[model samples]
Target: MIDVRDLTKVFATPHGDWLKAVDRVSFTVAPGEVFGLLGPNGAGKTTTLRMLLGLIRPTSGSATVAGFAAERDPAEVKRRVGLVSANTGVYPWLTARETLAYFADLYAVPPALARQRIAEFADAFGLGDFLDRRCGVLSTGQKQRLNLARALIHAPTALLLDEPTLGLDILGRRIVEEFLELVQARQLAVVLCTHHLEEAERLCHRFGLLNRGRIVRQGALEQLRAETGLHSLHAMFLDLVGARRQLPVTSLKSAAPPAPLT
Candidate 1:
């Protein structure tokens, strides 16, 4: 349900030189797939997502979500995609329930249906205890849970999660993992951007390893191991970085896509 090709983003530095934040990246995520967009800080993972959300225009290339080009059919693309990020914001004065209802209205969901959806998500995420509390007073984990609920209010078909589990406790993380599994069961696509290798390993069917504005490696864990001769994800990551140093800065297509995760 998500397709990106040659997606590049360039920014002007103060010195008037170009900085390629994302360079010629390409990938596809089918319905029911969770593709991990992995990298350290400043790897352009977030930049790629912003472009997909139509928050920023790409310098070149194309991104399509659910068959709608992100740049041309942005409204349609947004209607079919839910976004959750660590940087997500909630209205400080609004109660958790109210916040969700407001977003549901923005998506044009009926009032009655919005209430039902909020109730379901509240139960699923264990937010009933704090549903009436003002967002400004909530703890970090509570706020993150509320953020997840907000993203799902309209029941979009695709999810773009950037560190969605960042502030959660173990229970909170478990809830999110369970939620992702449920969404995948219904054939929804998810793009997970995270620094937690174990989290990515547990949830992702495939991965795109990004570094210095490029997708240096991509594919399933097994495929990565075969290509790099590394038995572990951590080792594979180290090798990917190491290989980049040995070779000239160019795209490497060593890893092949694996079959969809069951």
Candidate 2:
């Protein structure tokens, strides 16, 4: 499970001004559920994910993963979560199998259990044929499979995916979608940040629509449609962002931020 309450982050810019990357964001993800954080570029999606993973500290508010506070117990929080990003790296010299084993070691999984998981993931992700191939020589799709496999070796109870299908072909995207279904079946909580409205509409149980670092609207697709009186996610998003008015650019302010949504 993931719980965030009034989570906010402000950064000091080079020009001696403050920028609110994430502003009073609050949401929850229950086990067996996928929560979509949908937004455009510079909408604070990445900053919020970083705060949840404990990669950076929040300026205010709180976040907890599986009952462990991300700021107070970062290690425990990380133990319960797996993260996947488009920029995830694979050690060039290591084989796909070796990469999984290495992360298993980092997570301190028992040697016997690590082997069991490696074998399981290899089959589940269809990595058997090239499981021994050097990562540097594998195709893009192959490397991404390895990336997902490596993240799950420890059997994290929650997953965070940021643009997991950014540059994939149809087949590559299908693999990721299948993997997400597997996570759902296993009853793990997942938070997916993506720009693909169609993918989110298909997979997420609910969504939080972010604009200019604030959650302007959030709910299931039907709920959002009713609230905005807009039939499609694309149309609702455009209205919320004022994109039809030449996409109004919101200026950053360091004053008291808006109250978070319930």
- Give Cα distance to truth, residue 102, candidate 1, Å: 0.5
Report every candidate's CA lDDT.
0.89, 0.91
Which regions in candidate 2 have their CA more than 4 angstroms from the true location? 245-262
Per-residue lDDT tens digits of candidate 2, residues 81-162? 9999999989999999899999999999998999999899888888999999999998888888888898788999999999
Cα RMSD of all models vs. native, in order, equals 11.6, 10.8
* Steric collisions counted per model: 0, 0
Index of the highest-lDDT prediction: 2
Candidate 1, residues 147-225: lDDT per residue as tens digits? 8888888889899999988867888788789878878987989999987788889899999989888998899999987
Q: What is the lDDT of candidate 2?
A: 0.91
Q: Can you give the lDDT of residue 262 in candidate 2?
A: 100
Estimated TM-score per prediction?
Answer: 0.90, 0.92
Q: Which pairs clash (backbone N, Cα, C closer than 3 Å) in model 1?
A: none
